[model samples]
Target: MTLYHFGNCVALVYVPYYLAYKHSGLSEYGAFWKCVQAGMIYMFTQLIKMMVLATFFPDNVEEFGSYLIGDFFKYTVDIADLVGLHFVLDGIPGKGHSKVLTAGIGWATAEVILSRALLLWVGARGAEFDWIYIQKCLESNILLVQHIATATLIWLRSRHNLNNNLKTVVTILLVLSCYKSLLFESLIHILKLGTWLGLVVKGAFTLAYGLFSLSIYAGMAELMGIY
Candidate 1:
């Protein structure tokens, strides 16, 4: 197997154990299990969405550059996926935001493995040394971090009082999550610049996204008193 496949291969095993360890000692193990369930649900939701849309829309890989049409589906899938996490977390009981963390871990861990890793292994086999893959990995990590924060923020949404400010904040976060998801999945189409230039552009976007994610995560952290 190629190095890309190997990395994804190792991750398939490593990520589960790693996330399990991270989920350990912090919350009920059941929360992690629920997270897994939610992840499965989210995956199926996307698959169904794709299956239905395939009747009308072009295959995303082939027509990803058709910004207007492609993005509608992208936004639909991403929003549904992220918002579905909100309902998933809300279904679970117990407070203190550990459940939120568990849910995020579950969601991120599942996506990184099932979607990112597997897709890269299958489609990017020959391009083991490609800069795009590195960019893809970076975007995945950023989104993973954002997913954790999204869970916490969504969890926070209900716990907080009914106020305009809180509503606005939650709205901002939800929008941010959807926005990031679209960009990460589709930005490659826009990165027509050569390798080095693309990497530079990707790097800049990733850095900005990381900082934005950190600020949101920090806000959630403060709410949880992690600081």
Candidate 2:
């Protein structure tokens, strides 16, 4: 899509979100401090994830050992992330949904910060980012919110699901875990292949994932009669 088209899409989504924010007085959730705490958890878990990946999943991208091997490791890291998020945020003080959103923002913020920092280190700013970089920024925000959506599922399970039905919680976490694992696995394929098809697939999957995340958020909001 063109930059203008994407901007319109973002605006369309933003308007209602802004309206809800105003009506709910959403700031009472203390998103900022909670985000800081969530960011810290993300950073810590990210470091551990990297260490584990490097130690076990190392450089399979260079060799042809990438497909099965990389996927296995990707699943490992995804599970680790789930464990970390559960460890830090489960049964905490705030409302389940609000806290999950802040935690997601915090996690997404760390990701964007570290990613752009690496780009700057490589002088990527010298490249044509006027349009591409803006798109990346927007894409990253979608992803960050996706993180929140995943956390929300997990949080809702912890708060209400298992207490209601074990089978339902298992199904939800499993589906979301596969969703998370697929994204990471696709990313590896993109990096290893470095082909146009790979790039296109990666971008396509990212957008699809973003829409899925937003849909879940909207579903949850409606389900709870929050809006």
Candidate 3:
């Protein structure tokens, strides 16, 4: 039974990534190694984030104000993800959509494997049943959407001929996406949200961002003749 449960969790977590790579036409481009390269960069970015946190933010605080200050700085470090994405986009060789999909999928896959694989291995295979593992799988799906939207926006921002107005909006959206967890944390604290409720809210947020990103991308593709 444990093995069965673990298999289900693994499928829930990973099968979408496989399906995405196969069906998104990235396979035809033979972009596998490119994605592997992006994933390696993702891991390196994470390692740097960890080292920075450990080196500079060594002390933990008990007070709420101090905690908030510390967390804000920690979240600031997440800006490195954009820098990492920039690097991922820089060297990728393909059309606009392919580059975006490759970078997004690779980055998200690396994150899920590094972050959730161990948790699923230990908890999902245990004799005890828990809804957290299931919730985590659902969360992973949302994260995948968020990452792809982020990649599209980053790629869009790179085109020098883009309208300044669109560039500004994209920059704002990128910052919002980067620090969305901080906003969600505040809302959860203020609203006293439950676990499942927070997940629902997060899904809603991801959906909104994704729709906006798609609209912007469509306009840009038409404008720039990226096809």
lDDT of each: 0.62, 0.57, 0.91
| The candidate that achieves the highest lDDT relative to the unseen native structure | 3
lDDT of each residue in 95-165, candidate 1, tens digit only: 54566666777677777777566757665576444546555665565556566667766765666543567
Query: Between prediction 1 and prediction 3, which has the larger lDDT?
Result: 3
- TM-score for each predicted model, relative to the true structure: 0.66, 0.63, 0.96
State each model's C-alpha RMSD to the native: 5.0, 6.5, 1.4
Writing each residue's lDDT as its tens digit, candidate 2 over 1-227 gives: 34454454445334433443344434666555666676688788888988887877656554536566566556657666676677657634666556666665556666666765454334333433344444444555555545665666666556442334543754465465645546655676667754444445555665665565456556656767764
Which of candidates 1 and 3 reaches a greater TM-score?
3
- For model 2 the local lDDT of residue 195 reads 42
| Residue pairs with backbone overlap in model 1 | none
Candidate of highest TM-score? 3
Worst 10 residues of 1 by lDDT: 20-29
lDDT of 3 at 43: 98
163, model 3: CA deviation in Å? 1.6
Runs off by more than 4 Å, candidate 1 = 1-5, 8-30, 55-66, 123-128, 160-162, 181-227
Report how far residue 172 has shifted in candidate 3, in Å.
1.2
